[model samples]
Target: MAPVSLKKLVKRYGALEVVHGIDLEVKDREFVALVGPSGCGKSTTLRMIAGLEDVSGGTIEIGDNVVNDLPPRARNISMVFQSYALYPHMTVGENMGFSLKIAGRPPEEIKEKVADAAAILDLTHLLERRPSQLSGGQRQRVAMGRAIVRRPDVFLFDEPLSNLDAKLRTQVRTEIKKLHARMQATMIYVTHDQVEAMTLSDRIVIMRDGHIEQVGTPEEVFNRPLTKFVAGFIGSPPMNMDDVTVADGKLVFASGATLPIPPKFRQSLTSGQKLTFGLRPDDFFPTGHGLNSGDAEAVAELELPVSITEPLGNETLVFVGFNGRDWVSRMLNPRPLPSGQSIKMSFDLSQAHLFDLTTGKSLVA
Candidate 1:
């Protein structure tokens, strides 16, 4: 953040090249999330930005200054790590004031800064407690306090809530988002969780195989993914993907099921052209005299024997298999679904996605 720019960035270890050339311009005060699967270079990229790792190629500029050789502290950035990186022996006050003390700030100034950050993060009450006495959320807050007291031009978060329980993670996610709004400071967060990326990011750089798959707002990446990988990776429950072929001007799945192609899509595909069909489970629903009913062509019914039924308080997720592939359907209303019952399911092709089989690129632009 603070307008970080990576011009043709690359990372290499001897003969192994992990990150190819990547050019990105991160605007000042923007909260951008770099998200991808493991080994996809998201962490490596963040480390490089933090000056924790060396860039094998290209230039990294932080606020108009090229910081290619600067150390982490010299880069004027504070990072909240996944491990919390808090000293167990230090009290919260000491932990939060450590950075200021290291910078040779006067004791009174350090004390005032720690107090201010503690108040901001609601950690003032726990200022005298050791990390050993704190809960996971409290410890994480102390780490954030440690980072915020520096008042760095930019902040880096490397999955800081990964260690927390589900409820805590959710709470911290909201807190982090609100804190960003409050601070109005530049930030770059890295995570593999799609929900984390979608909820927290102002803009996301979707990464794959050391390359950027797509970079856009969450809605853009979810509603109109540029690549097959982005479409599959960025959705909860994931988008359903299956081999498909154009037959008789219809979208034909490999299992012999057929769905009607949208008018624009039907005109684009060549008959017999091999493709892949993708759709989020939430995009499909029982046909009613409503929004997507008439638009869905060739409603192929599936007599699916339910394999698993997960009924939460507000919704039900039914797991069913079809032709060696698992299909999940999310029902908003809570309904008891008995296993082995033949459930009728349909595909809504109007909102479906078509990918080129060879290139894994979206066919319907």
Candidate 2:
């Protein structure tokens, strides 16, 4: 029952407060990711949880006890940093067993623990190799092996895969996921990559300006973002957004382009209200290439000119001219379209999002 609970957590230096009073709960053996752009205080928050940074306000509980006053070692947590932080001179086995050695554990116990972790991480064959002898991915496995030997209640990972190349990152990401399944430890990962957060975490905590924007499962956050920022930030290629004014039950773009207000938002909207219209590339597609198969009544069709096309293997990204700007649409089973050619484009209004322009909040419900 090693659940982690943060109650009104805060971090400050002098008069400058960085992490605001944020509350979060990570269930036992649950993987949670803290993700946001740089300077969002995600790493700071993780450090505070690991006791590497002093808490300025409120309590942090690991399991059933408050750990604010505990030191990093006493808190019984293992952290794997972005920089492998391995001993250059020590062999893989030595590096993994160093913590236990320093703690005055029996030599045989240390050896057994290191061997078990090495086997789990597929490092048994490389136990004799030093950090310099290992590849980037192998070195990362050693880092994870070191953390695994500790057998802590919680595992803290601070952008551990950022240093690796894309291919290596993917490999290590899968390894980390498998490690979590085998260990069932309460792991808290901090990364700026939303893809990593989406693929690795059971739930995601999206942060902005030192504050938590939203916390939800990947599917929840993707299909139903609570705020405009969440909708725009969580998706790759991002959601297309444009400012509009409500007029005669229509959303009128600044360039005089008008679209019928999404049916679901009709009751919540008022004429003359300003809004930010959002539609993902998947929802706005070249007709016959979209993913949606239901509710044609809310779909809007237009003969829009194609501005550009990016062919990506199984699908293509088509940028169409709309509302004085280029709106991207995803095309499946793609066909080559010459630039500037007029094509029938579909906007699945059933999946469109409307946000308050001033507040940047979702208008549905």
Candidate 3:
């Protein structure tokens, strides 16, 4: 069945604990990505799952068997590293089949498995090439090919695409997605790039400071972040946040900009309560230029001076002065607004977020 579960997993380096008591589950054939900034213990957690590190606390189960004490090889898992870890002297075919060869598989069987994996990864034509002779993307494919030949119960990838250039990363990302669909094997991927996690994973496990911040599908995490950190970290360009106070039934920012409290939050807030207001660039757009211009009743108007504008082909990222800092907004069907120019922007408060200042948690139920 290959369902994996971590029960209160903990990792400590001597007296300094890194991974706290975190629990997670990976259903068979489901792809999950652990993502966070550096030193979040994501890689450490993955290593623990691979049996490369000792667990300081908690139990890990693959299917129904507890695998805490098993060596990596005995755990029946394969890992693809960012380094591409292929032997420089060996051909791609030989590299892909090395693990089976080490297990004393017959040459014919190794060849067949390697050939199958190569065809699946489209590395058939490059099988004879050495790692140094292949492009970065090809080497990564060969690395994936090596893991595929193992046919393990779980696949662990640690920032496998970070070594590739931007364009190649996208290309290989698509390949990995296809590979998962083709094999339907349980996979756990770790990366710092939220975009990678959002685009590639069935569900994302966002970690921070050795703790899991949130675990949900991409939409859930992006649209309904449970914590202020998750809301800030999940989106592209991030969510625009400002310190705000409840005053006279309105949200008053430090810069004197006042907005009506979102109707859903009005009953929950009281005057003088400190809060943080969050708005994604997607929901803050210029009037007459947003995705839902027809929903005009939901829009709140604001006049702000443009700080800068970044044109991103189909949509433009507009930066304007708000609450003493540049707040970014995404404008569809955009027109250029020069720096320092005052423009009327539309804010879709229906999607706005409110965080309790003291708890750093979302105000939504």
Assess candidate 1 and give its lDDT.
Answer: 0.85
RMSD of 2: 1.1
Report the C-alpha lDDT of model 3 over 209-310, residue by residue, as the tens digit: 999999999999999998999999999999999989999999999878899998678788999999999999988888777876355666789888999999
What tens digits encode model 2's per-residue C-alpha lDDT throughout 255-322?
99889988888897889999999999999999999887598989999899999999998999999999
Write down the lDDT of every candidate, Cα atoms only.
Answer: 0.85, 0.94, 0.93
For this target, which candidate reaches the highest lDDT against the unseen true structure?
2
Please give, for residues 204-319, the per-residue lDDT of candidate 1 as tens digits.
Answer: 99998889988999999998898899999988888888888888877777777677775658668889899888877775532231134465453445567778877767766667
Two-way lDDT contest, 2 vs 3, winner: 2
TM per prediction: 0.94, 0.98, 0.98
Clash counts for all predictions: 0, 0, 0
Instruction: Kindly indicate the candidate among 1 and 3 with the higher lDDT.
Output: 3
lDDT of 2: 0.94
Query: What's the best-to-worst order under TM-score?
Result: 2, 3, 1
